[model samples]
Target chain A: MIIAVASGKGGTGKTTVAVNLARSLAGPVHLFDCDVEEPNANLFLHGAVERTDEVTLPVPAVDAAKCNGCNECGRLCQYHAIASFGSQALVFSELCHGCGGCMLVCPRGAITETPRRIGVLETARSGDITIVTGRIDVGVAFAPPLIRAVKGRIGSGVTAILDAPPGTSCPVIATVTGADAVILVTEPTPFGLHDLTLAVETVRELGVPFGVVVNRVGMGDGRVHAYCAKEGIPVLLDIPDDRRIAEAYSSGRLLVEALPEYRTLFTGLWQAVGELAAKKGRATEVAR
Target chain B: MKIACTTTGNGLQSPVDPRFGRAQRLIIVDTDTDAFTVVDNAAGAAAAQGAGIQAAEAVVRAGAVALISGHIGPKAFRALRASGVKMYTTDAPTVEEAVKRFKAGSLTEAKSADVNGHW
Candidate 1:
């Protein structure tokens, strides 16, 4: 089963939940940190990454010598990153979407695509679990490509747990899309509740089966639980405000390692996710 | 030269908001002659697929030589710059105030918005 762990707000223990769940879950597991911008799961897991791959994007390089300034490349580009008119063409690398439209429309074949290094994908093994992650280079505008690279490393027969980035944006979509189920981790505060609402809407729109995991549960108000109940979304697991868990997190330690008792809780969480996926299959069959 | 002032809503001299993608209106002003025309940007929302480029094209088609706004992203900036339109960035709260600042030569070219935060 492919289960995606996501959060609406940053620093809400989404990674903590994901890492621990992978550690506790039985059978072969692949833990993919799809949060390419800043992947922190490696920091907590003590393991050797066996493989790494570079992720690149195709960027247009204009050869100005052979080009007549037809401006067709510019007109064809939806991004407007290129402009060719009156014997001069300028290309902005930052705004280039790597669509290759400019090269396709270039009458002189002056635009050639060159690989621009955007990020790297790393794969590591920790006993039974295989962790694959993407790390985007600083100053790169896109994350979806890197996120896809990480997800592509999934091997067969492994229960994949994807740790998605925060918020309802492109990166988040790339991580959660096509997963069997999603576990949205959120706190109980107003900001958490507000962003969770947006995230709920996003996942619902995608028609994915999802449940809520309330982290730092006792610290904030009980409004998150209230909202979940009202919306008919199940609160799958609740990790209370514990000082030991906080310390373990700050020192780059998995919660299951620090607190072995939490392993059973995570195992139960995984079971619950499996149940949800089974229910989704039944519902889809009934609809069909 | 007619200039487009990025605005929060579709009206004459509306407040010049910072958000480019969510801006409700693209207020077109004749900087040279002091005439006004408001273009509704309700159809072209920000960060949506192809919306930023479309909005830039709409502004350029309106014959605006320049764009005045609080912040512009790399995508929108590239779209406008490719069309030979200059952009003046400022934190002015109102469109009228921004035009006044532009006329007085007080507004400076805006930079890309900070992408670090959870916006």
Candidate 2:
């Protein structure tokens, strides 16, 4: 079964809930930090990175020698990535979607698909827990592609947990989709509540079963609880505001490892998730 | 010289649209003859990404040597400037007023983009 931990707003404990849940769960479990823009779960696990592979996107490269500038490729490009002027075709790699339409439409065979390194997918292991992370190169604007690259490593029969990127944008959608269940981590603040509404709408539109995990419980008001109750959404767990947890997190220590008592909490949270997914009939034939 | 002014309506009476990428229409008018053509900018306005760059390309293709708008984003600014298309900004009440300002040399040319594109 695959479970995705997501949050609408940043710094809402998505990585905390995801890493802890993956570590606490019994049997072989894989954790994918799908927040390619910034993957931090590896910091908590401190596992030696076993393997890494460069992730690349196909971008159009223009060949000046092969060209008669028909302007067909430039006109056909929806992205305006290929601009031809006075027998010269300029290919802006950053804007190319790698759709390959430019290459196909080019009458002179001037456009060729080229691989551009966008990010790297790395694997690490801490005992039975395997962590997969996508680390995007600096200045890369798109994260959905790298997120997909990390999620492609999902092994069958192993409980795969994904810590998704924040917000209701494309990257979050890519991570949250195909999950047996989704756990939305949020704080109790007003900003959290507002963003949570957007996230809930996104998952609901995708027709996925999901629940909420309130973090830093004592930091804000009860409006989040009120909103969830009004919407009939389940509040699976709440991690209280504790300075010790913060200090441990800052120093790159897992909550379950630093505070032995919280191990039970994460394990119980996993149990709740299994039950929730099972009830929704999404947890199919996955022996836990 | 042809100048393109972002407009709210098809005619010169229409208000000058401040937004460069999301403008409704681009009225390309010849400064010498006052002959003009209106290009629908809805496609760029509705584009998912690179709206500013696409609009800049449209301006370039329209044979407009200059652009008049409220703001020019970095992407469009770079493209227009690269193509030697000078850009001017105005809060003129109508497209006609903006063109008049352009003819009077009262409109200030934008040296660089005022804002970054959202996408």
Candidate 3:
């Protein structure tokens, strides 16, 4: 089962939940930190990354010498990353979506695709868990491509847990899309409840099954609980606001390691997720 | 001088709202006359693929010699500069406020909004 752990707002302990959950799961599991922009799950786990691969995007490189600038390439380019006027063909590297549309339409074959390094994918293993993390290049604009690159390394049959980026944006969507189940982590605050609604909407729109995990549970009011109950969404787990958990997190330690008793809780969470997946499969089978 | 405003919708007051699809409509305001004209972004094709050059082309065709927006991404900023279109970055509450700031020469042009990272 591929379970995605996501939050609508940053700093809501999404990574903490993800790391502990993966560590506590029985048998072999894979953990993917799909938040390419600033992946922090590795910082907490400190797994020895075994391999690294560079992710590249196809960008048009204009060969000006052979080109009669009829602007056909530019006209065909939906991205307008390439423009030809008179004798010159200009390529704006930043605007290019690497769609290769310009290369396909270049009548003079003036435009050819060259790989532009955008990010790197790192893979590591710790006992039963394999961790895949993506780090975006220092000056890249897009994250979806890198997120996809990291996810592509996922091996089959391992229960993968994706630590998704914050917010209900494209990056979050890219990470959580098509997962077997999603765990929406949120605090009990008003902002948390509001953002959780947005995230719930996004996941629902994708037709994915999801449940809520309330982090720092006792710190704020019961707004999140109220909202979840009203929406008929399951409140899967609650990690109470504990000073020991805070210290563990600040020191870059997994909660299960700090409080070994909590391992059973994560195990229970895993069981719940398995049951949910099984139910989904049965429902789909019924439809067929 | 006709300055173009990048808007989220067809109105004269929206910022670069990401919620709106890439079909950017250019709001052209004649500085001297204070009259507004909305131009269907000629570069809508660029936005279909979320390209910056197409956005720049839309603003340029709308007769804007300069652009004022909340945030301009790197690709779009480069395209705007290449086309010799002046850009101003401001978190103006409304489109009219942005135009006013541009007219008063109080808005500052900014670097691109794309966060640099390894791809």
Instruction: After superposing candidate 1 on the true structure, give the runs of residues whose Cα lies further than 4 Å from its correct spot.
Output: A286-288, B1-119
Per-residue lDDT of candidate 2, residues B1-119 (tens digit)? 99999998988898998899888889999999988899998888897667877788789889998999998887777777767889998889999999999999999999989876743
Model 3, residue B10: C-alpha shift (Å): 19
TM-score of 3: 0.75
**DockQ scores of all models, one per candidate:** 0.13, 0.25, 0.18
Better of 1 and 3 by DockQ: 3
What C-alpha lDDT do the candidate models reach, one value each? 0.82, 0.88, 0.80
The best candidate in terms of DockQ: 2
Model 2 chain A weakest 10-residue run by lDDT: A279-288
Deviating ranges (above 4 Å) for candidate 2: A280-288, B1-52, B64-119
Candidates' chain A TM-scores = 0.95, 0.95, 0.96
Q: List the residue pairs that clash in candidate 2.
A: none
Give model 2's docking category.
Answer: acceptable
Give the 10-residue window scoring lowest on summed lDDT in candidate 2 chain B.
B74-83
Instruction: Show the colliding residue pairs in model 1.
Output: B21-B46, B89-B110
CA error at residue A112 for candidate 2, angstroms: 2.0
Tell me candidate 1's interface RMSD: 4.8
Instruction: Write one digit per residue (lDDT tens) for candidate 3, span A25-65.
Output: 76888999998888999888888999998889999888878
TM-score of each: 0.73, 0.78, 0.75
